[model samples]
Target: MVELQSGYKLKKLRSDRGGEYTSAEFLQFCEEIGLERQLTVAYSPQQNGVAERKNRTIVEMSKTMMKEKKLPYKFWGEAVNTAVYIRDRCPTKALEKVSPFEAFSGRKSGVKHLKVFGSICFCHVPNQLRSKLEDAAVKCIFVGYGKCEKGYRVYNLQTNKITTSRSVIFDENSLWDRDTQTVDSVTVQIRSEDTSRSSEEEHEETMIDIPSPPQVLAHAKCAAHIADTELYG
Candidate 1:
């Protein structure tokens, strides 16, 4: 992207000594673009005060959120990402009650869509995706907001997969206490009406039996499972 103020082309790149910036492909790209580079000394965070402070704030917020929700260390990445998302939409000390999101986008962001991190949710399984005898919704953990779509990012407990879905019913009021032994899953028999479904259904549903999350660390799976998904998914 070109500079918006003077409309001048980018000429230089100043950054810390990170592996991402020093990669061969990135170096080649910068070279091809004739972008001069000034790399800061290793472990010198003071050279970039704004970014350093922001990173620190995100880390603190993530840690607080994880501990508050009783989520394990394995879900740290998701907590960090969600903390950033929440922070961007919140008022900053540097601004006059303006959020970073509004400062850049030139408009206020919608706050209604925001949900509690690691809350239990029910993702609607479309009629086409399931048979009449099959369940209508799947129980999942609300991890984060969707990146590329207008939806939520959820971790399916039964299928052991991540999915982005607009048709999700969140249960923010219900929280799990870390006391019971870890189990595979629990059954949640929810009595529902036609309006209970996210994607409004024509026919009424008697019961929406979905697998409830076990009373473990809120959204934490085994280290290998959740960490990879939080990083790559």
Candidate 2:
């Protein structure tokens, strides 16, 4: 798209010997564009110092974000994007106090829409489509701002899908944890009932009827006396 839009035929393209850049289609495209493709030596990343530095910076920042937010490893992509997004707008000594966004676009970047990464967010469900039993809003974990798409990247626990949303309600305070309400309550109640039932059963067993030794002896003596009297008569 850039080649087509530029209208000026590309002259030289310098990059690492990556599969995408070295593919036959890319080679053909470069040939068609009258472009020179220059690839750096394999394993000699020092030759590509700028790209290598940026990659290192992104990796370090991404790790920092994940560690800080306590997010899952699968969210590395979102962390990388957030790291790049913030770095792109941060002022540096080389840029003379001007941010990368300002330097590139010649305009100041807006910080109004910025949010904490991994914050809890609630997205409203359309009322017309929502069922009576369904919640009015769906809970989500904020990942980062979308690049190509015009929305924020969010992770939905219920759906297990990382999707984009234009509108959302954010809760920077909350963190994700497993819900144990019903199960825990039910287990406690069941244990209590079991304990009560066990105590009652124990009390009933302790009160079981048993004939006294004195009563049994007295009944046997009376029978023997009656038999003796009948034999003598």
Candidate 3:
């Protein structure tokens, strides 16, 4: 896709001697395409420093995003995808003043619609999917962007499914607590009296304005710093 968009013909392929890359079918395909294959020495990642560094950067960014949003590790794939999506729009030393997206597609990338990854969101439920008396939106977790569609990828908490929708409302300030009984599969039974008491307690806790510890605050600051520097540098 990149080569096609950039109107460039790929000449050489450099990669580690992974099984998938070393397969006979892959080698035949490359040979047919008249492309040279360059394989690094076994167990030597330094030979592929650029790719390794990029992978590490993506992983680190994904981890930071998941941690900041208090999202579960199960959403790591979504985080990684979102990180890559953001990275393509960010300026890089290799690309000089232009971003990877612009360099490849010949057009500047826009970030106006980007939202906080893993933030608590509400996706509008289509009228055909719900009755008039039912809620108009479903609670979800903002995951990433739709690759083939102009929409946001969200994790439906009620249905335990990932869905894409153009209509989504995000609450960037609030994160879903994973420890709470939010998943539909895990049902918690409570007595009528205990439910009322717990509701009151939850309200009181919500009203309390507790300050985050210095360590957490520092971590968040550091994450933001890294994001700005590595992504936009």
Candidate 4:
């Protein structure tokens, strides 16, 4: 499909001596299509430097992304897919600042719609899928871009499933690890209600306390020290 779209023909295929590529059916297909097969010697990766380096780059990128987000190992596939999607749009030195996607498609790739991978987001839920009082959006994690659709790939935490959707609101500043904030908010609300009742019960007591002048100065000094430490460190 890519070759057809790019108006290019596969003249030669260079790869290691893998069994799948060396099979009789494969050779016959290659011969029928007039494609030359170039096999590298055993244990000689240098002979296929381009492919080896590309594979290394992809794996490293995927590992870095997964590590940065602290994502589970099961999501490695998604990370690899995202890495390839980004790599296609990124400019290469050999291409003189032109991206691989642009070189192949004869058009520049647009990255305006790209979102931060592993960022916390809210995917819009269809009205028919929920009740009127239920939440309209469900929390999810941004994973990658859809290949055949104009949408983003997100992992629905609630459903333990991955889905592609265009109507997602990304909170790039947040991460999946911080999802506990929702529960913490509810806990805080409950504590606040208890505290309010206690305060109302204690309102009858005439007790007052105020910081001394020296205490106020000490608090100001502490704040200034913290600011200076943060600024310099």
Candidate 5:
């Protein structure tokens, strides 16, 4: 509205048949402001060439970013936001070295806070929920910015959900190794089983064997009879 008021007297406003711009409230406001409302036909988005082209450009950029980073499909929103953010500040042929941000804001925008998308971030865990034995933070994937809050959208590893968190430490140089300890665990289990079986076999061989009770009684009686014979003689 400010841009419209600044540029012209707001004689007419044109848009597609989207629910956002074609609501009754918007029509009433336009009527009150002496502005003519022009809406394109239903299912005819091509009539709005500039908007459609911009949308296509942003979509392509987002796809390129996702492909380059090998990011998951669920992170499309983040990738798109990052693409738009970068595109806005980047110099374009039409702008002649002037960025969209500088053109809109009349000043250069700072790019210091930008970080690589899908990077590892450790978000601080709240003290109330963390146990003494647990770590002080949780690892997460940096997705994008928060739409409603003043923070970044981070996918929490523990919760398996996206959340806005301001407290995060980015590990840009780190990448997750999928099978770092896979072979070591299997080797350790095999060695432990082999050791256990060897010990069991050794114990079985060291067991002592004993004679039956009837053999012992016969030997004792024979010794007693010999003593009696000697005494009689």
Candidate 6:
């Protein structure tokens, strides 16, 4: 797929010694395709640290994106896809001026149309699909970008599936639930009360507790008495 899209044959594939890469079928396929498999030693990710670190970076970024927008687990695949898309477009020190996407695709990936992943959107329904008196737009959650079309992909709540629309009105400031949100099954955050209380307690513990002047005097006297008793006895 990579070779077909990029118009350049994949010469070498570098990966860790995973079962998927080491399997007979995969090896045979690679040999037939005239591609070299450069496998690192088993359990030594340091040999392939660049690939490992990139995978970790993508996963962490995906997690952050989902959490930041209060997106559900069902949208994790979309989040990961978006993460890779964003990562490719991001400028890296490895490449001067051009992004990874630009370096590979020979053109810059425009960011002008990027929108919040889980923000609420209203997709315009065509006149043929809607009745004369019926509403023209449907509420949806923006999932990702349209691959085949110049539009945004959104998950329709009423239809319970994803659909792409170029005429998408996005309210980036708002999420799926509009001005307010109730307890949503797929997206609500369940935090431990004990953990919250413990954090508050920890904050309090960090502050200096100043003793009263009388208490200070008493403490000083007690220390002096103990010292004097030790010296005398």
Encode model 1's per-residue lDDT on 1-233: one tens digit a residue: 33684467888787898899999999999999899987888888888778888899999998987776676787888888899999999987788889988887678998999998877777777757875445566777788988778899987878868889998777764444447623233345555566666675555545544434432223323433454468778
- Global Cα lDDT for candidate 1: 0.74
Per-residue alpha-carbon lDDT of candidate 6 for residues 1-233, written as tens digits (9 for 90 to 100) = 77777898779999987789999999999989899999898889999899899999988988888787787788889988888888888898889867999998888788888887787776767757865445556667888888788888899878889988998766565555423642122323333345556554533323333343233335544554565478778
Please give the CA lDDT of all the candidate structures.
Answer: 0.74, 0.72, 0.79, 0.76, 0.67, 0.74
Question: In model 6, which regions exceed 4 Å deviation?
Answer: 4-7, 177-233
How many steric clashes does model 4 contain?
A: 0
Q: How well is each residue in 157-192 modelled by candidate 2, as lDDT tens digits?
A: 778898888867665544555353111110111122
Tell me the tens digit of each residue's lDDT in model 4 across 139-172: 7889999989989999887888999899876666
Query: Root-mean-square deviation of each candidate, in angstroms?
Result: 13.4, 27.2, 15.7, 17.9, 26.8, 23.3
Q: Estimate each model's TM-score.
A: 0.69, 0.66, 0.76, 0.74, 0.58, 0.72
Give the winner by lDDT: 3 or 4: 3
The prediction achieving the highest TM-score against the true structure is 3
lDDT of 1 at 195: 61
Q: Which residue segments of model 1 deviate by more than 4 Å?
A: 1-11, 176-233
Give candidate 4's error at residue 131 in angstroms: 2.1
lDDT of 1 at 61: 91
Candidate 2: clashing pairs of residues:
none
Who is ahead in lDDT, 4 or 6?
A: 4
Candidate 2, RMSD to the unseen true structure? 27.2
Q: Could you give me the TM-score of model 3 versus the true structure?
A: 0.76
Q: Least accurate stretch of 10 residues (summed lDDT) in model 5?
A: 181-190
